[model samples]
Structures are given as C-alpha cells and as structure tokens.
Target: MSEPREITYAQAVREALRQAMQRDPQVFLLGEDIGVYGGAFGVTDGLLDEFGSERVRDTPLSEAVIAGTAIGAAVTGMRPVAEIQFMDFITLAMEQLVLQAAKMRYMFGGKARVPMVLRTPAGSGTGAAAQHSESLEAWFVHVPGLKVVMPSTPYDAKGLLLAAIADDNPVIFIEHKLLYKTKGFVPEEYYTLPLATSEIKRKGKDLTLIATSVLVARALEAATQLAQEGIEIEIIDPRTLKPLDTAAMIQSVCKTGKALVVHEAPMTGGFGGEIVAQLCASEAFDFLDAPIRRLAGLDVPIPYNRELEKRAVPQVADIVREARALVRGEY
Candidate 1:
C-alpha cells in the first residue's frame, strides 16, 4: 500500500468530489457561485472546467431553491451534492430540509431514497460575525431522517464525505470554516469511513474528552499540554453527530471515570448536552468519579471583535483548565 499524502482539508474535499463525479456520471453539483466562481471557499474550484457547466451547475441565490432542487434530483435517481454558502444561511431552507428531504424516505415507506449531500461551512473564526458564523448542527440532529456529519481532520473530511454521498439518506455534511486550510495526512485513493462510528484520536487512561468539529483540534492541543504535566487525556471525536458512537464514549468514560464534552456551539441546546445526558443515563453513570461536564461556547451571538470572538468559544487553555479540574476532582 502507498503512504498517505498530506493535503489541506479543502483540497481533500475537492478530491472526493472529483473522484465521486468521475466514478458516477449521476453525481453532480449545484449551488450559488459554485460553477465558474468556484464556491465561497473554493472547495469546488476547477471542477466546473473539468465536469462542464451541465454537471457543475451554478444556481440562484436562494437556499430553498438549491435544497429543493437537490432533493428533487435525488428522488429522481440523481446524486446531487448541494452547497449552502454558510451554515447560518441554512436556516432559510430549514423547511425544505427538515420537512421534505428529511421525511421523504419514511413518508414514502422506504420506496424513495434521497441520496443527496448538503455541504455547508460552519463555525466562527474569520470574523464573519453572527449571521455568517453559526454552528447549528443540533437542529438537524433533532430531525429523524437527516444524518449529521462534522469531520475534523483532512482524512475524515474526505472519507466521511464519500460515505455520505453514497448513503441513501439526506446528509448534513458540516465543514468548519477555520479548518479549510488545516493540513493533515489523507489517502489519495477513493475511500469511505463508516458514518455512525466515532474515532479515538488519542488514547489515555486519565480522562475522556469528547469533542466535535473545530473543538477536536483544540482538544488535541490541550491534551499535548496536559500530557507534559503527567495527565493523559483520551480524546474521542464523534465525526458523525446524529447517530453518536455512544458505546465507544461509554467505554472510555467508564475506563477513565471522568468525562468532558466540548464543542464550539452555544452551551444551551448544544450537542454537548446530548453527549453528557447519554453518559449519565448509560452504565457509565455508575463508573463516573465526577459529574459529566460540558465546556462549550457562550450562549450569545458570535462577536465581531477578535478578542471577544476568541472568548466566545472554548480555547486550548480553556480545555486544559477544564480537563485539569475534572482530573483533580476540582469540578
């Protein structure tokens, strides 16, 4: 087997789209500024030239239309990968996504399939402010039919994306805006990672830290710092949020006897709460030496000021502090 190659998260996603389109003629892309303009973040850059205008389409500035069109194509036996400019904009198409795309398969009694992928950039870092930088993944995870995926590294970004496109259900594939240029080792070959599986990125026996999206990277950094102080933190990244890998998480928490859930989303109504609740209700509850804690973003609009924005979300130091408190029985 060949060695894995290093590439940016954005490049990995582009490669997945290219390979999927090449392998299946039924696969096509449609979204605002996705064609000649190469998408808002350039993830779809250069595809228009290779696949032509018919396949790499540029649609109107209507999120509802883009989502509606993708659903229509998917039900008609076409694989449509639609892009929402930013996650915040997805609210405009919630009716189409939550009501139509999510309920199609069940409403049709498994006779219909919506093999479509809705890719959107989420989270805040580049100062896009409140309207452009929301991480509302919990909303989709609440829906029954939609599958939610938030891949952190370049490897999972490509692999999980391929799996999402191949699934016979509507997938909400969320990409973090700050992670676009982050580099990591990714296989050059076409590969797919299981959707509902969680990955233990780092192994430890001291404490279990379950982080999602951009927080995964931050948690790893904090782990490095804590390791120097003789505190080993086992980090688990739940790449797929909807169908969480609860068994894996339960096992980790049981072994460590302490757990901390982290995310960039607001603390109130965040996905972290679900993770904590799952741990509390599971057999892991008996094994817990401390209360399952959540370290998440402040429940406020993402600030425009740089420092304020930084304070809004959990930083590396914040993770380290929280982990120390949990391990030392200070929480």
Candidate 2:
C-alpha cells in the first residue's frame, strides 16, 4: 500500500485541478474571482500564479455566461472547468447545461462532445443562509447527459475530480463547504477513481448506510457509536450519484438486510428517495428486512440561525437516532 499524507479537502481539489491543467494544456479554468481572487473558497488559490492569467481566466459575475462560454469552449476542442461560486447559484446556468452542454453529443450525432467539468461548493454549516446553502445535486442528476459526483473524503475528491476532468461528457463535481478544511490522508501524486462507482467505507452486518457528500462523515461517526450497542452499521459512499453503483448497494443490502440512505438534501424529493427506489426495483428487494429508512434534511429552507441551520441537516446524533430506530423496528 502506498503511504498517504494528510491534506485538507480544499487542498486536494486544488491539487487535482493543478495536476490536470499541467498534464493537458487544453484544460483551462474560468470563473468569477477564480484567477486573481482564488475562488470563493480559495480552492483555486495560487493557480493564477502557476498557470498564468490566460489559462486561469476570471470572468464577470454571471453564472449563465460562465456556463455558456465554457460549453462553447468545450465543444471547440478545449477542456474547460468552470466554477459556480456556490451550488445554489447554478440555477442561473441550468439553461446552458440542460440544453447545450448536456445534449451537444447527441444533438450532433456523436460528432461533438462537451468535455467540461463544473465544480461548485455545496452544503451548509457556515450559516451562509438559504440562497447560499442548498444541496441541489438531484437537479443535475436528473439531467440525462451529465455525470454527478460528490466526494466525501480528501482522497476521493482528488481522484474523482481527475477522472471527471478527463471524461468526455459533462460532469458536475460537488464539494461540501464544511468538508473544505477537513483533513485526510491523500497521495501526493495524481490518481483517478472510476466514475459511477461506490466504495464501502466501513464494514458491518446490522445495517447498510448509503450516504452522500458530507453525510458520509456523519454516518461514519454514528457507526462508531452504534457499534458499542452491538449494532454494526456498514457505510457506503455512492461518490457518483447518476450512474450509481447499484451492484455494490444491492450486495451490501442483501448482506445487511437493512438500509438507510442519508444526505443533506431535504427529505421531500431528495436523492435518497431515488436510492431507495432503485434498491426496491433490484433483486436486493428480496432481502427480507426492515423497511429502508431515509434520514435527510427537514423539508424547510436552511435558516440563518446557527441552531436552526444545524437542525436543518442530518448530524451525527440524528444518524445514530435514526439507525437505532430502524434496527429496533421502531420506525
């Protein structure tokens, strides 16, 4: 096994972007404040110095224009990685992504491709309020021609990002704001994790926890506490949501016989519902277990108050509470 070094999630993402641009001259980055200001979260810090202004260009505060321009550049033989300051602001760019970049290949009879990666910071905890802190991955996941990726660990963030940049299709890469400064072991060199794949973070037999983005960390912390009560919870991170690793999920659910889908998104129409439906449609449905549960954000806008904001999303205590209920047949 290769030795790993500790680094923050933001650093891992910056490293991946740096390495991708270095290896491929066609790859460039453009977004508001990404060049001189180092991005909204400093993920692009120092890139302007290393890659220069031409490749690390900055644009006006227009999400629609940024998306449109990147899509144009992508189809014209340039690999462009655009940032949307915040995932919530991506609403302004939905037209270009849904109509243009997503359908370019099919619309052109396979002669064209939009090799672009859209990176954005998502989730709450910084009290950024409603507009700045919404988990909207489900929106892009519903789009056909786009790939959605959310990495919980620093390692997966770097590896999956590299893969997304290299993919020929449009990829939506989501980073949790709370995860930015969190540290984990990551390789100094470049690596890529296959898209549409899921990884088992922890192994257990009592139940299977399928979480996304920031909730993955919460699930792991809950798993540790649940273990003391003789309840072993197997945690799975479906890093890529669109081409979800169904086989891995089915296999885990079959073994555990109980499943819990966790995410920071709201419970109503959240991505967790999709996962539960997928499991029910698959052969894993015959596992003969307790009903699958989804512990997600309350069906309300994120509040500016720190206490209310924390209550809006799933926390370690919430996971432990929900998992205990599911295992005890209390749900």
Candidate 3:
C-alpha cells in the first residue's frame, strides 16, 4: 500500500473544519477569541481569513452563550461548531448542553434535532494549571442524546472531526492540548468516519489496553517497550466515548483474556470503572485469564506545579508498569 499523508494534530483538525466548512454552506464556527486571536491553540487559524468574520464569528467569554447560541443556530437550520476554550469551563454551559441540546429532540417528540459540534481541549501536560487542564469527557458521556468523542491520533482527529460535523446529533469533540503539536498521517482530502466506532491501533494476543485521547499515545508507547520484554499488547482507541465500541472491546478482551482501561480522569467515579463493569457484565468475562485493571488520575484537583502535575495523571512508564502487572496477574 502507498504511504499515508503526514500532518500535525492541529492541522488535521483544521483541515477537517476547513473542508467541511468549504463543502457545506450551513457549516460555520462561533466561539471566543476565534476570529482575531486564531483560537486558543491556533486550531482555527486562518479560518477567519478564508471564511470571513461573518461565519467564524467571535462571541463573549461565556460557554453558556456559545453553547446556547449554537443550539439555537442548529435548530434553526444552521450547523454551528462551538469551541469551549477549556473543557473545565464546560460546566458553565452544562444547562444548555444537558437541558437544551441533549433533551430538545426527545422532549420535542423527535421532530426537531440539535446538530452541532462542541470542540474543547482537555487534559494536562502543558502546565495549564488546574482549571485549564481537566479531562471532563465522563461528565458529558453520562448524558443521553449527546455524542462524546476523543480522538488520540492525528488521523483519527481529522477523520472523527469530519464525521462529527456531519453527525445529526450533538457531539462533544474533545482534543488533548498536549497532542496539538504531535504529528501523524492525515489524508489531504476530506473524509468522514462513523462517530461511535473504536479503532484497534495495535494487534496483540496477550493483553488488551483500551485508552482515550492522550492515553492512547502513552499506551502505544508502553506497548512498544513491553514488546521487548516478551509481552504482547493489543491497543484500542474508542474514538467516541458515549457510543463506546463495546463490541470491539469484547472482541479484544476475548482474544487477550486480560484488559486494562486507562484515562486521564480521576480514579473515583471515572469512566474506567464503568468500562470494567461492562466488560465483566458481558460474556467476554468468561474468556479472561486475569481480572481487569484500571490506571487513572488521582482524586484531586490538578496541580499547577509541573512535577506534581506529571504525577497527577497516568504516564507512559506508569502504563508500562501497569500493563506488565496486569499480564502477570498481579494488579
């Protein structure tokens, strides 16, 4: 096969938005600091120049306003892509997201739809402090009618964002801030993949490691290091968290007979707990040779101190150690 096109994570997302915006007249962007500032991470850079301020309109520093406005625009026939500066700030717009966008269709007898994309950056690695660095995808995933997505690689970021924009339901598109500078293969042309699908990034028969966003990269790295130690690790990235690809999960666990769920969220009440429960509840539990393992963030606010912050969340070495333990049936 031919070589895949390489692109940065930020550029991959920009290409998705640019292509979708260029292809569909109804698609537009509205958020804070997007027009003149080029976005917090420059993901929307040059978009205003090409699409103009009319479509790439800037709004106040209010997540509620951005969210509510996008929902209204969507219901009225416009496809609006809203950007929340930080995922932690999403709480400001929770009412609009949960009450308005998520419930509008079900409450309205399925006659109306909230077709919008909420793009926000989450997780810590850039010394962004507590409030600026939070992985809050679990909060939204619990709500029905809202699609939650977290793409780990550059290719998935571009493909999933394109798929999200085309989705009929409201989608929470989360990007890990630390992954913006990372590069990978991205097709130059526009493409769309299903929102609720999971990807098997690496194939193995010894163990299954399911991760999201930044954790996917860390898991893959750990798998490479583990390879030298005579251990095989199968890695799965559930690009969409809400409609989690449980079938892929079951298949992986059935093959490996062991599973590990890792994320950047706090250990208490995080989504990993739910994932483990689901795997155990399914028929796949019978195939397991060892118990499932979860390695997540600590139950505390993210620290501003760089050294403390690094330890707050799961790291590469930690995943390697955890994976080793799980395979050894010691975790």
- Candidate 2 residue-wise lDDT, 260-289, digit = tens: 999999999899999999999988899938
Give the CA lDDT, 0 to 100, for residue 173 in model 1.
99
TM-score of every prediction relative to native: 0.99, 0.98, 0.98
Local lDDT at 45 for model 3: 92
Better of 1 and 3 by lDDT: 1
Give the candidate number with the greatest lDDT. 1
Q: Taking the tens digit of each residue's C-alpha lDDT, what string does model 3 give over 1-331?
A: 3567788999999999999999999999999899889999999999999999989999988889899999999999988999998998999999999999999999999999889999999998888888999898889889999999999989999989999999999999999999999999887888888887998999988999999899999999999999999999999988899888799989999889999999999999898998899899998899999989899999989998988999999999999999999898787
Model 1 deviation from native, Cα RMSD in Å? 0.7
Off by over 4 Å in 2: none
RMSD of every prediction: 0.7, 1.0, 1.2
Computed on alpha carbons, the lDDT of every model, listed in order, comes to 0.95, 0.94, 0.92
Rank ordering of all candidates by TM-score, starting from the highest: 1, 2, 3
Ten-residue stretch with the least lDDT total in model 1 = 242-251
